[model samples]
Target: MAEMIKEPIENYGLSSKDRKKTLFSKIGIVGCGKEGSKIATVAATAGIEVVFLEISDDRIQQAFDRIGSELDMRIATWGLTESEKKTILGRIKGTLTFAAFKNCDFVIEAVRYDDNGERSLNHRKEIFHELENILAEDAIIATNASSVVITELASELKYKERCVCLHFVMMQPQSRILEIVRGLYTSDSCYNKVCQFAKLIGYDFVTVEESAGLISNRLFFILLNEACAILQEGLTTPIEIDSIIKVGLGQRQGVFCMADQMGIEKIVPQMEDLYKEFGSLKYKPSPLLLRLNRAKRWGVSTRIGFYEYDEEGNRIINENEKK
Candidate 1:
């Protein structure tokens, strides 16, 4: 696939006049997992008051620690002023209670995707119903669901018009693209506000219609699944498969390496769910993935996967390994 350079966010579907007029002050982020924590850190750094809510006390503390460490590293690596880092860190608050979200102008749900490999409409409805009881009447709700149908999730809520999918890539502060998926019932104001927020935070936004597995993940999983199948069929070694993609397709990383980075267990469940939902053979999980995940050999964090990481965090490939 060719790399398609995207138009600037300011030049996208939203108008500049509308962008300047949108409101964004207090924001709430639910789920302090990998992507959620990054979003909170970035939004806080952009001078938006941010409150992070997670299900458990442990997770909330983890988010706080992760954000603090990341900001400190960023300051040193990028030569950011100490005062600037202090201001950014000061703007963020972490909580385990939902009441903290009462004053938020916008809420972003970064919760786990359901067993269906999509943000279940029912799940969103449950949260929104509770939120409506506690939150201000007009607070907009956005989800960070990558593949779920946005319109479906929106329609399940009483405030359907104010709900949309604001899909951020894996690492929010580093990745350039942010997809604003407008649901069928999504209001123009909500859409424009999200577009404006994306621009303010230095991200390029693309407006996509409600679809299961929006552009990036849709294309990415299809390719990743194919690569898994090729490996499962014993057509080539993992190294050879990765080399082919990198050299022939101009990809920065190969499938096995990407899978290792993503965690084989994490992607397997989604692939299995997608296969069940879409009935596509391409969505089937590879046998190797199943075996590895079953063995609890999850990547980096677990210290084992396709390649072993040394004490210094270098990936050491096993030359004599063959299944």
Candidate 2:
């Protein structure tokens, strides 16, 4: 299929007065990890200028390489052109500090997980405070957190109404829906602006209340936990289990496959956080997941999770799997 441009190409170099009328003309992404990079890519591809913050020069380059590689994937399928890739790259700038985000109209914090992919809530809170200092009072500040609540985080901000939570489902080619959470102090205008920005990026916004796990992740974790329990009982193999869900339940992808793609390391922390919040045994990270994480078998990124994957992120199948 040919590439689709949902709107007129934005002229990012317009004068300040003209730029002020543009919605989300400049986007800031804090911590260009997996989710952050995707958010940065989506904004830049949609003709918005994006400035992403990383901790060091090396990390900045790493983010650039990942984004470039992804764009190359689109180029391979003839969905994007080499020149278009360059233009997208040009729209995205990497910075080591929050100062570059000062002019950003909207800033989203997709803070990096630890080296082990474990989340640090305090670290995310610190990023929000730093963002508040760097951004204008009216600029929207968002967190790309699935299991973390936004209300407590926004409580520390001066313009608490500007704080919102945005969760982007990181599926391939990206999900068309954005899970948007409005905190207790989030203003109606602030929430409306974020919804408008989501539409600008070709996403349908699902307005959800402030809660741990929101809509997508909360429902997903429950299924993932159940899948883990079934697997633990040796009732079926991963392939067989996935096949049942794919064929019978009509799911595009099974729970284990989704978990693997999301990285076992990342899933554990989210499940743990959910468990802590709701005090539900169903939210507890499965022992099987814990074992895989401890073994450092983080899905496609690490080339192994519930199943093995090649460097190209394609699953490796045995010859018998062809049947």
Candidate 3:
């Protein structure tokens, strides 16, 4: 039997201080949506060449524009020098084809549910197959999926050993914690490389079993779902619950506020998916969530999730606006 490699965190060589840096210059990011763009920006900032692959020219332009704005924000808020910001922005190139990933040392799939609410696993699988056909054999394939099983996705690929999951927290630039999950067939070398790369990019790495939702989202959504359930049951009002959790638990922000910041539309569907997969009572989507989603109140993006936002994107709460 092959020696079982424990979680990467337990291995000495894979420790943050001991892991070797790779010559990973070029990285390809598929689905330049929210998390995708953030991943691309971080890699680019670290001087890694980035090719952002999306389905359309409009999306490619939108991603580039978003990255540009983010780079500008980092310069102002994080005290990044103008030259440093320029170099970071210069490392990113947007493309509409998977062919651009040919020379990439790593390809990360950031595509999630489509606009039509269809999960695009097959579409992403096709992209992975195409990348495998074109990219170097040594290249690593990664997914940013929050709920999908990395092992299941890896099973469809030719290089299953080289494929793993690199789950980042919601706010990529600010959030330091990253969940690094290894599939059953993931090679030790590939796992080690990814662990090293996580440290290289300055994330606090936590190794998790290849479970759906991993650690952070799994625990987080449970709490969020419970908070939603309480609100739906009329046991407590949003503000009341927020006040209790903040004051009693010493939390900086309330659950609903954090949910609003995370975007309700994004969280609701994932909650539903998790319920379907796990059949856990706690995973059930709250009625309040279902109602809000039906009403198209999708949080900050839609300007009306748990709380309403003004035309200028400032969150506004009016007692009269309560549903």
Candidate 4:
């Protein structure tokens, strides 16, 4: 005989309705550009709710299109189902006001660069203050900053302890590791929570002291500059150098190729920031980068950089390699 069910209906719904809420169930992103879009996609893929703020409706639509296209590529390469893509896209929303982030557990500032190819620190600081006023005291405020220090951004916040640095490397998204930096006022609780956030989104985390460039930029910049120096010395073509690095050293992408993807205009300013911070020649921008920046060949966004690209952002390979 079949056993009679004795459990109440509430018992079945207990885990569904009464379970403890997740720490980062909902997150807010200040900008939805390349960096912000990557973070939004990652969080949404992990079943987290995401709301990103854009300057206008057009930008919001552009972000959605960019995210949708990225998901399409994943569908082709990673066997992600179209249904899964819809689910991921469904979890994300875009807004035009900071008030929309009122309920977000974590808010990350990833604003895009201005026309001058630089992000304004004043604007970021203002964003932090705006978020603090709207967000709960317990909610965290973070920046996807590379060269800027977290302490400076957190200095003006009422809840400075909640502000931290969370840098994501856009180059190697498959092996992307998070570099987390704790500010002068970052509490132990805040830092630990960020570490949990990293794991929640399927990333490995490294605890870093407050510093400009953190781990990713400081190391990557030197490698890139040295590679540029070799090119300057008439050593070899970019293809040859990339071949040796990829085949011999097992690098994921050629140094110059990575720079192109990163945008020469942005790289020069960041290099200058590092150089100013460390007072070292190693942190200085390469002359080649300066030339590219001056000429407005700012990488895939412009379809040109150290190498040329087609409209689809695929680098065009010519039989005669031209710098």
lDDT by residue (71-122, candidate 4, tens digit) is: 9999999769899999999999999999999999999999999866799999
User: For candidate 2, lDDT tens digit of each residue in 121-181?
Assistant: 7888998999999888899999988777899888888899999998897743547789898
Kindly report which residue stretches of model 4 are placed more than 4 angstroms away from their true locations once superposed. Answer: 1-20, 320-323
Whole-model lDDT values for every prediction = 0.76, 0.87, 0.79, 0.90
Clashes of each: 1, 0, 1, 0
TM-score of each: 0.79, 0.90, 0.84, 0.93
Candidate 4, RMSD to the unseen true structure: 3.5
lDDT of 1 by residue, 201-238 (tens): 88898888776566776676788767777877889887
Itemize residue pairs with steric clashes in candidate 2. Answer: none
Q: After superposition, how far is residue 16 of candidate 4 from its true place, in Å?
A: 9.0
After best superposition, candidate 1 residue 181: deviation in angstroms? Answer: 1.4
Residue 192 Cα positional deviation in candidate 4, in Å, after optimal superposition: 0.8
Model 4 weakest lDDT span, ten residues long? 12-21
Tens-place lDDT digits, model 3, residues 33-95:
777888988888777899988888899898988787777777788768789878887899888
Q: What TM-score would candidate 3 get against the native?
A: 0.84
